[model samples]
Target chain A: MSEGTVSGAALRILAAGPGVTIQDAGRHGLLRFGVTGAGPMDPLAFALANKVAQVPDGSAALEISMGGVELEAVDAAITLAIAGGNFRVTLDGQAMPSAARLTLEPGSKLSIKAGEEGAWCYLAPCGRIDIPAQLGSLSTHTRSGIGGLQGRALAAGDVLPLAEPKVLPGGAMEIEAPVLKRPGDVIRVLLGPQDDYFNDAEIAAFLNGPWTVSVRSDRMAYFLDGTPLTHAGGFNIVSDGIAHGGIQVPGEGFPVVLMGDRQPTGGYPKIATIIGVDLGRMAQLRPGSVFRFASVSLEEAVAARRAEAAEVVSGWALAPLVRTSLSSEFLLGCRLVDGWVDALAED
Target chain B: MSKPLIEGAIYDAPRFLNSGETALVVEFGRSVEPEISDRVLSLDAAMTALKLPGVRETVPTYRSLMIHYDPLVIDRATLIAQVEEIASRPGTAGGPASRWVLPCCYDPEYGEDVGEIARMTGLSEEKVVSLHSGATFRVYMYGFAPGFCYLGGLPPELAVSRRTRPRPPHPPNMTLIGGGLAIVTTFSMPTGWWLMGRTPERMFSPQREKAFLVAVGDELKFEPVDRDTFLSLDARAAAGEVVARREALS
Candidate 1:
């Protein structure tokens, strides 16, 4: 349908889980004013969702946490894609893969439930989110109550205005969801500006030992629970600006990895920093998930980041979803021309 | 030209701390002082002037400048080499930038810590207000919260430890002091710093043309106003008017 044919464009939330908020690439160049550029926890997944939805590279999307969301199209049919955590997704009543591109007709309900793996999920629509950009971004910094919908988490009865999707939905398509974590996969980190504060024994213990993601984690930072690390020197440092994934060890001796919504500066001594490409992987590790930090050289970290960027530019491989209900009704409903290619056909 | 002057190069040699693949912290010194702050601001200004590709943003702190960049566009070594070259130049840290006379209301209602502070410092409540308002302060940096201004130059007599227990969330624009730093909070947040008063002028406003009112290295002087005046100015400021008076410092 064309833009005018659809009724008022909006998405009405019937139910929402915690930490659900609108996000874009992030607000940049304002950190000097103490504003944090809060964005999606999983940047790669966010980008993939936008790509699958056929939206512009950095269009705003809903960042749903472990607890999922249930919403309905309000007077407009909209095309969308879900990515990130392997969530259980249902469009109207048909169960679909977590990372699938589909359309929600007017009054159709889309439900995303927490599944077997991952923590953060992305729900991207193929249109500009009709929200006023605060300080040049739609990314929500909930701690400061700035940006997004009233600078807070999305809740039931919230109506988000949506613009007409630039590209129309062609057919149901699916892609492999981002692999947030795998068994034995170590999160890589770079040793710090304040590594000297920790003794050799402490450093070894930190790098060699396992640390569980604490339940106290949020968008700001993830607190690690393990043998509390003591400092060889003072716990506090001269306050300095913090970078995303900077691992600050506080007086309490716990390592807090600052994230997308972290404050601009901090006084705690940072012992290590997670490399850029691995930050998303680290963010997706849910509470109680066990992981170890593996130290990587500066050169290696940069190379890894470059490799990921190249992959993003090359684009993801999309596949057609095949339903296998071998009944007469299911056979009759299948679109013969849609995504139907002979197995032996050559390009 | 005489070899480019190295102004505010407090450190004999700066230290480059790699935060990750995406950022580098050029620390000028180990202490918080005007010279160190000057070095941070000067390097920040130089980085801005150069407009180096891949440099996304630069945050100036008390003794270091954190430069965030896109690693793909510019590698760490190249970025550091360029920054080091700029730091080697003479007179990089320019002089004073601006001065502001911000209106504050120290009426007991807003200045909740006035009595407690006066008792601790062995000064009268009026004396405390005068000492705080009369002193000139410098904008060292912004941190901890959005638009929160961390100012230096608190009078020694007025210096006090942070609250033993953090108070409940206070409203935005509340003037606060802890240790040697004076702050004007941009949003309501629980704080251990003593609330000295409240200001009508918005230190950081997303609605205003400039989101942050003052920049690093600027001078600030608090002009105490009556409660009624504070309410009147607060309303206008809320409506997006720049109520705080400012002037360029020559």
Candidate 2:
């Protein structure tokens, strides 16, 4: 069958989950063609789900927000994984962990209930979800009505194709479980290139003020409500390329944190950008959650990221012996015996 | 051809940030202006044509063109120099220009605020529609929405401010006026522009071989079509039967 031809298998959308859509890495560098990269708000969640399912790094996955999606698997035997936010999951009436791999038979009914905590959840199948790539991405850009399920939210009776399974020798390996905790609303930021556009008082207010995440938040941006920061300069500025996490202060004065699907450029003055490490925390923030910006140096941010990476490498190094029964004394004795055998063989 | 030296034109070297660890933004100006957009697009086309080393992609906007590169392959300064070289080159003096005739329907169902626009412009609803359809417009830029064309010409009588309060939902293919100019949107967007009419034509089609029907510096003329003509044209466009007609600027 041609790509994007929906396999006879159909997944019924029982709840039409809130903010759920198909997402890949995103449509990249197509803004000159007037396209925005609409991808997963939490890249970590999407990546983790793909990893857990043993799928390719950039395969398309269901990005369900605050979960209300209910579906029954159709004509394919598949392994599925869920990651990111904490959401209740049930498979054929049995409860399942949020971030574990599950092998389901064809026609298995899966339901993801409303999430008690966190904002986004990701579901990835072992084989890639067959969706047409537009401008080189399978992600849905709802604002532009392009790519993924007719460029709109998934409705009932929308059938999606799952790629043919190629099982690996060991199936999927389980990683160390993350210690779940409530997300703090404190967002760490670094002063932006245009930080000087605001006065010292405005900057102080921006960092110290309690800003509420407005109800008007979405994949494009999170508009904050708080003390309207007053800048010495006027509202208009030379339009500039906007990076993700760039805090745009529109005429309204409240800052809007541009997210994954943001316009490539903007004319608004930006005060600062929330650091990349803190973006995951920002993604899970619920509307009306109060937040304060804590300024940090770029060096500190880089160090934090490096430390996180080191922890992952170290954890992987210890994975082989995680469930092994050999004690330190037994291992030492085995090593000694091996050394003796080596010397005898040399003789 | 000799390169024209544009005095007082400012240029900046490209810079990188670790937001995605791969994407670098090449900023040109601090504010929004036609000149900045033109310069950015010129550089964008040149760099795209050159296929610079380590550059995966580039996005040109109103002021800056963001170049996404593989950090594993290229360093910051090298990418900046490549973009600067393209920007400094004088190939084409201005941006690309084209002529397109867009069909519009002034039916009240589509133009919900035609009476309001008439009230503001001191013209009858028919006069408002006629004056809008009477002249050709130059495409200033494509912005606010994908494939949406911001046209630069409007008869002075129909040059009206945007609505005092924005409507909840504006239909797609809306011809609007604001800040002494008319705009033809290819996508659905909330706007303060004076709602005059709607077109059945889809300005943006991601599935199409050429996704965007209009581009920057294109000349656009509005052809008055009734409901039947709008439906037929829309169907033809969707069926991929209609070819965009381009006429030389007289």
Candidate 3:
């Protein structure tokens, strides 16, 4: 609806791989209307991609899970940034950089291989993707059949329009990255409203137990296969509002961690909530990956979130660079950012 | 006779159940009942009207209203106190009630489980339909899914337990009876309720100028119709006709 023109550089989806959807910050405050805020599972990575592209905070990005996507650019030149869990990426047979901005030319084929470590990846392009916003959000709620590109994922031959390029001063800037483990193990949590439901022994077991992320996991909830927390009271309670990262203990006792795109309300007793700062780490843990929950006080959770937020805000303060010249060699050299270099050096 | 209001332990300052760094659940009651729902709804209405600073939104359920706020703008203590003050205010009675007529098709084709419901209630299919259409039921809450109305005051003779195993997928607009109550589904949700009939009316429409057809505290009466009438009414509603109307209970 913004006066942005549709560009000729269309993305041709060659593989149309598994569970790739366009996501943004998600629609909020519509739960009373039974609409869940369906967005990227890892908001941290999504925000990081936007910051790298210098796109606005709520700009639409491709949420590609388990990779295996191949797309060819059609016409216009665009700046694209890739972030989130480690993934194998290649552009025209050369290795592409993750967590770095790259200038993509017309007819260039960008291929993302399967993710070896993380569960999700984000692809954000400069200039917001043009799509109809439903209920004040462009993020897709696949269950509710609204938002995104016709409320669905990108399929083969889908031409999504990108806004025209504007010239900005400077070249591509990459930040000094922090060292991250391939698959993060410990997920930090804060005690919840129903923490008293479980006794000292059950609480201790829950914190110390190594829970495998069950295959029944999705954007709605992650079913953890681990120790069954005993409850003196029954599991059934009055149905109540559920928030993202709320650890719900159903009748079976295995905790189910509610996630983005979860139901607006549920009845299961929630024992705890994963801290906001560690939610990204939890989201990246692939199914079958084992994780231990570490309990932290409310104060500690707030402090961790503030520390992360401060880092992101400072990261965005660095200005983004725009490219004027379009030589293939120059673009290739730029694609060899620190992330790609680190991976190659390790190899 | 009205039941006496049982006052629970009152908290001058609202307590927070740490949900996450960004969100917390501000619980009002521990049990689910009409009085609890009333308190929750009152708090919900008061908060919405106030439009507190940094409060993104509040969701009212049977007993609790989850207030989601921007932690950066407002701290937990301020929000809890604001909600507590609103909840403690006198004369914050529950919302008023309204009467509504719901036309339902009782044909076996649409009401797939009518025979099962009749068997469970020990009444004939026609008797079951008549009993369901005979009374004006009070709506207790609107939840479980968008626009799904949970109604009370079903005839005791017609009262029947829900199916032991829930249907994998219950149809939208299915009139279901369970636990001495009846529910009209606004969205597709799995249910153990005995499905007696179906209505073509769109109970929940996010795109509509008025999103929900019925709210809490509304009285609903089911009017049985044949398949032909159901089809015509569906068409009329699709054409933007206001077929749903309210009338005095017969």
Candidate 4:
């Protein structure tokens, strides 16, 4: 009810994957009440998707996992931006780039399928989503089932109503696929609030790890598989508050990096925390991919985060999409159709 | 790997652990106790009162306070200094927490693990129920799941290690015990604990004015009820009534 004005635009999920859910900047101030902030897995990618759609920052958007989703514009034409992960997409039989923006004519189908890289994708519309906020967030924490699309994943036939758009006039646009620095690069970490619990050898094993991302990974935590870590001090710690990217090593010794939807508090000792700038890289890692961790100073982590924040707000990544078939000069000169195009017209 | 400067002063004073670049954990102690919980909650209240710029949210747990803030708006050193000063100040009393008397039914049908628990603890079923219901429990904090109330002060006799194999999804609203801790589940979840009884009182209801029924520092005592009375209360609670009764403990 606290959402904005409805312009009657809507989108219906024709098909969806298990992990698909609506997410925003995530619920805040409720962590004390045992609520986790279930924001997008890759905050950088999520923010970029919203920027591409010209929606306000942190607008509610669909988080598509590897299984992908099929949707259709129902009531009226709506502009959408797809970002994060290299997902195969087609708008009504026309193949589109993995990360692209397009106006879906009413009744038109849009399909996004699994791509070769990345584990999560985002689909954002250029309007406010009509779903009511729970505890001041649209981010769906599926474990608790409290926010977004009835606090659950979207299923086939679920309709998403939209409010009036901020900027509706734009043609199809696409961006280059996101590139990773390296296949097995070092992810920076800050050693623990509980590092003392582990002896120097265990800490060395953690930092020197070429750990594999477990198949059991989800929004809650990414379970790493490698040499099991034994606690020097006992496994249990007094249950304490956990933050996103806190790497908690249980008695099993395999570290579990807490994600966006991690529980507010945990009983296991946290060995280290992944730096903010590296979290997106960690999130995009496909299951079975190998990675390592390197320790960094607090100053370095802060500096990296501040720089990344500036880049996100700078609109540096966004550029007008140019179709390969049409020359940039030709496409810029021509005035694309602003309103609905006749389906029967010849190209 | 070289430790951060923050870790150097940790041993000398309160342990302030960095949680990534955005959050810091102000640990008051190494174990769970009323004094530690008191310090954590009081600091949480005092910090919230300050309305410090860039402080996004704070999670006050059993032994530590984790403050989530925007590093872009507030630097780490300044935030840590403010917390240390507030923590050192004397005589910050927490508001009186509410004491709740929630109705629970320990019938073998509803409390599926009651017989097993009695066998494990070397006590009769009636004695197990009496011992559990007799103790006055304190709410340490809510975590692991939404509105899942983690209660402290379970009787030593009732305490047992968590099941080696966690059971598949158990029904919600059960008063469960394990690993020296007690919890009233708000939703159906796979728990490694022993289910002692079922409660008609909902610990969490999204539709309710207050979604979370209990708060940290609140005192709770379970009142035994018969199967028929539990059924009636369950029906009433499902219809949106707050079946649990409470009064401020001044």
Model 4, A1-347: lDDT tens digits are 11233367788999998999999988989888888889999887788888778788999999999878999877677778888777898877667778887777676789998888888889999888888999899999988888988789999999998888433443666654343222436889999878988888988999998899999999999999998988876788778988889999988789999998999899898999998888878898989999889999999998988777766666344345433486666654443323213332446
Lowest lDDT block of 10, candidate 3 chain A: A166-175
Q: Is candidate 2 or candidate 3 better by DockQ?
A: 3
- Better model by DockQ: candidate 1 vs candidate 2: 1
For candidate 2, the per-residue lDDT at B147 reads 70
Q: Give DockQ for candidates 1 onward, in order.
A: 0.50, 0.30, 0.41, 0.59
- Candidate 2: CAPRI quality band: acceptable
How good is the docking of model 1, by CAPRI class? Answer: medium
lDDT score, candidate 4, position B212 = 89
iRMS, all models: 6.4, 7.6, 6.5, 2.9
Rank all candidate structures by their DockQ, best first, as comma-separated numbers: 4, 1, 3, 2
* lDDT tens digits, residue span B1-250, model 4: 2333332132334677888888899887766577777888888889999999999988888778999998888998999999989988873756447999999999987789989998998999999999999999999888888888988889999988899988998888999999988988888989899998999999888889988898888999999999999999999999999999998887
Q: Which of 1 and 3 is the better model by DockQ?
A: 1
Off by over 4 Å in 4: A1-6, A176-184, A315-347, B1-13
Q: Recovered native contacts in candidate 2, as a fraction?
A: 0.30
Query: How well docked is model 2, in DockQ terms?
Result: 0.30
Model 4 pairs whose backbones collide: A229-A253
In angstroms, how far off is B204's CA in candidate 1?
1.6
Give all candidates' CA lDDT scores: 0.83, 0.68, 0.72, 0.83
Residue A194 in candidate 1 has what lDDT? 79
Best candidate, DockQ-wise?
4
| TM-scores of all predicted structures | 0.91, 0.79, 0.86, 0.92
